[model samples]
Target: MPAFDAAAEFDRQVRTLNALGYPALSGRTEEQFAELVAPLRAEAVAHAGTPDEADAPYDPAATGRVPFVLVVTRALAPIERTMPLTALHGGKLPGFVDRTFEPGSLERFVATEEAEPPGRDGVHLLFDVERGEEFCGVVPNDAMAAVAERGRSLLTIEEGVALMTHAPRILVKNKCFSLGGSRSGDRRVPAIWISRKAPKLGWCWAGNPHTWLGMASAGARRV
Candidate 1:
């Protein structure tokens, strides 16, 4: 079985983002993104032999994906800001906001009261990310509470987008996830899933439950 390649993943992420013109969309230059990840790249190289424990908790032998995700935070790349620029399946299909998500600016979807992302500008490496697959069919409200009790914070809209941005395959036909990190001062919870075989930025009612959607979470975020 193939193991997760942290270094290669990091490099791939960088090149993919640069190819997508990520830096410019986030008020950064390609050179700056490279500079930001230089140390991270080095660290990845040094630790290439062993991927982070969190990256593979959910059947590493089967998935071969990593625990953490490389993110350009809402501070640098708001959910709405990154929506048009985001894509699915390794940048093959561009993402878009659902017409029903008339919430104007996706930034309005703020982190929930119990959640705390590394609220700073620039890049973040989010570790131990759970796609909330277990939370499928769980209502958004209950799922958020369960996440808190487990000492994990739900993924914010920005983080959700970032996760899919880096690992597009994670957002599949029936295994989509909710951004428990955000709420629009209403019963709506922001989520990402496939729409007509394409990744979509959309919302769901907090009170409802879906057999296919799970609440996503992360153990930690940092520079």
Candidate 2:
């Protein structure tokens, strides 16, 4: 697993959200996002071991090493929804849970590749909300980034949701890249979702925003 660039990924997602005309957040400046990511980055760096890239985690599967895992947290609604079932235990919700909601529901319909070794070789996991299944796939990080960059200009709401849901590997890459920077490897990145309802709250491992949008639209006064 490579150390993930959470701030960069967040920037990319914000840009994508803005391009999609779904922009809602503004108070957390880039600096703030960077500040939030700093500790995680530091943890990655500290554990990285070898100095000057010599001790970096080696990918037996890949010829090189890459830092992985970019965790990002965002406010989705003003009032957060609770999932007592999953939270009651110390176990965290898997990243795939986002597929159960509206937009992500579409992901269950798509076909994707299988997971592979980490480093350069990208692997993605999809949680099918409709079917109650989880799918894994192999993808190129750069390829995923390209799709996201293109999605900024080419994707429709339906397409975006579909991509976000069914093709989460690509969506994560897109979201990660859209948030900024890039990653190389088969690593697990966690996204925390915050509800858009009043008195915003956070949920661990929630990545899709379809449900959040509904709340946002309903709550808006439309100035």
Candidate 3:
């Protein structure tokens, strides 16, 4: 992993999304999907370099530390449709939301102003990610404050899902993290973790702290 040629890197992400079958889930073919996100290539072109190294919470893999993640906003591929398509353990199985989340429960979690992506709909580009595992054991509410204090934005639901979608290696056991960027005006904080050795979409109490769950954040984004 070395410095990336931004255009090539962006193309790689588009290929990844196509390979993940995202287009089909959204009722589009690979070609249509690519066409939809073609604008992001121009956006990605402006950001050229990406770090290749990663510490704990983010595994050491070919992807290393993700420089940026491309998101097909919920407007294009809804979480309810995409979550089940997320694969783990080399695609041996798929991801699933915890049963506790009733239908439409996910819709309640909206991105906080600090964590909102630059794009209002369609695709987005999140840059300078700091997975925020250091906040593990800190209550979600407190972690949110810490992230803001550090001048970083918490990862929104779509951003967190996109991270795992392209970099499954990041979802390590006992090192999973929460999406404090999305809240339902209550205690529930969305999270992605390993359940039964596979990726899982779940939630945690905002006031409670889990030694294994850190709150994730990012530095910038683009439409």
- Tell me how many clashing residue pairs each candidate has: 2, 31, 0
Cα error, candidate 2, residue 113 (Å): 25
> What is candidate 2's lDDT per residue for 8-122, written digit by digit as tens?
4334443443433232332455555444434444344344334544334333123211222231211221111212111211224322234323443322222122111122211
Give each model's whole-structure lDDT: 0.73, 0.25, 0.77
How far residue 57's Cα lies from its native spot in candidate 3, in Å, is 16
What are the per-residue Cα lDDT tens digits for candidate 1 across 171-209?
A: 766678888788778888888988855678788999999
- Models sorted by lDDT, best on top: 3, 1, 2
Instruction: Answer with 1 or 3, whichever has the higher TM-score.
Output: 3
Give the candidate number with the greatest TM-score: 3
List residue ranges in candidate 1 displaced over 4 A.
Answer: 39-65, 103-105
What TM-score would you give candidate 3 relative to the actual structure?
Answer: 0.87
Would you estimate the TM-scores of all the predictions? Answer: 0.84, 0.24, 0.87
lDDT head-to-head 1 vs 3, winner: 3
